[model samples]
Target: MSRSTLRRALRAGALCLTATTAAAVIPAAADAKVGVSTKRLNIQTGSRVTVKGHVDAPGVAKLQVQRRGRWVTLDRDRTNRSGRFVLRKRIRGAMSSRARLRLSTGETRLLGRMNVYRSALASWYGPGLFGNKLGCGGTLQAGSVGVANKSLPCGTKVTFRHNGRVLRVPVIDRGPYVGGREYDLTAATAHKLGFSGHGPIQVTK
Candidate 1:
């Protein structure tokens, strides 16, 4: 073979080797960035849940929840030596709220919905009951959010959805002892659902 031809082949081989090395390095660089996720994509209200994930380096992660379209801090903690963190807490308040694990690196991992329910005959009560003490606790008010059922244990979480709106409220009271009605929602819940006096709504166990 000619010397010039041999030299040309050597140059092409060197270029191919350099290209392969660059491609390999790209992924390694990307992996060095922070990433996070929750152990369970969906969680039930009032249940202890954990958000576990890795940071680019050992550091803190801020757990936040979305309420009224704003992100509010739920908790904060640091990662372990392995650059991984697990934040465990009993989640309460609005169950339909969105949540996420956010790192200082500006990376975030969203947690999915916890409760998904079935359809039921739902009715709302409030006007005349306002200022009255609830059967379970707290007073019945226009802004109260909850459901009343005949058999379900008090404080049991029930998911409801109507007219594109969703709510996961506890069984704070009993009844709708009136037949054909499976659940009774408070004024607030009904309003959020765009429900009138009565109608069919979704319910989750």
Candidate 2:
């Protein structure tokens, strides 16, 4: 080839080699060692949850929670000299799934089972008490979504699941007040779950 053609070919070859090297180096950087953990697997709403984790290197880490089909920022912190981080946050909203902890380096970790969900035998009530004052404070209505528990503190959230349906409600009333019944779901809650009568159910507190 001519001198100019040879020079051009050499430049193109050099650029291709450089690109190949970068592609290999990029993946190595992405294979970072990072991990995270939570203080508890299950907790109540408005309670503080502690998150602790470590990265392979010291950097800023971000905490996020999955809500309404999206990931939202919960908190952020800088790792210590040992690449360890501690973040404490009060969970105020309803999150049905685990929270995510991600590092600036692209390594991510999951904090699974972050809230209370349980199984129980549950029945629903509403018509008789509709418009009547609940034991907690609110007036029961057809649209009210909640559960009645004999011992669980009022305002505690309860999630119900049956027949492939799910409903997250609050402990707004007292109880079913009958033997063998663990929870009494509000009319709206039962309707949402396509439940009609009593049966084996899942109730998360």
Per-model TM-score on C-alpha atoms: 0.48, 0.50
Question: Number of the top candidate by lDDT?
Answer: 2
Taking the tens digit of each residue's C-alpha lDDT, what string does model 2 give over 5-77?
Answer: 9999999999999999989878544455776654554545567767877787878888777766887777889
lDDT of 1 at 137: 83
**Positional deviation of residue 204's Cα in model 1 after best superposition, in angstroms:** 1.2
lDDT of 2 at 138: 74
Top candidate (TM-score): 2
Can you write out model 1's per-residue Cα lDDT over 1-38, one digit (the tens) per residue? Answer: 99999999999999999999989878543433555565
- Count of clashing pairs, candidate 2: 2
C-alpha lDDT score of every prediction, in listed order: 0.74, 0.77
Model 1: lDDT of residue 118: 44
State the lDDT at 176 in candidate 2: 86
lDDT of 1: 0.74
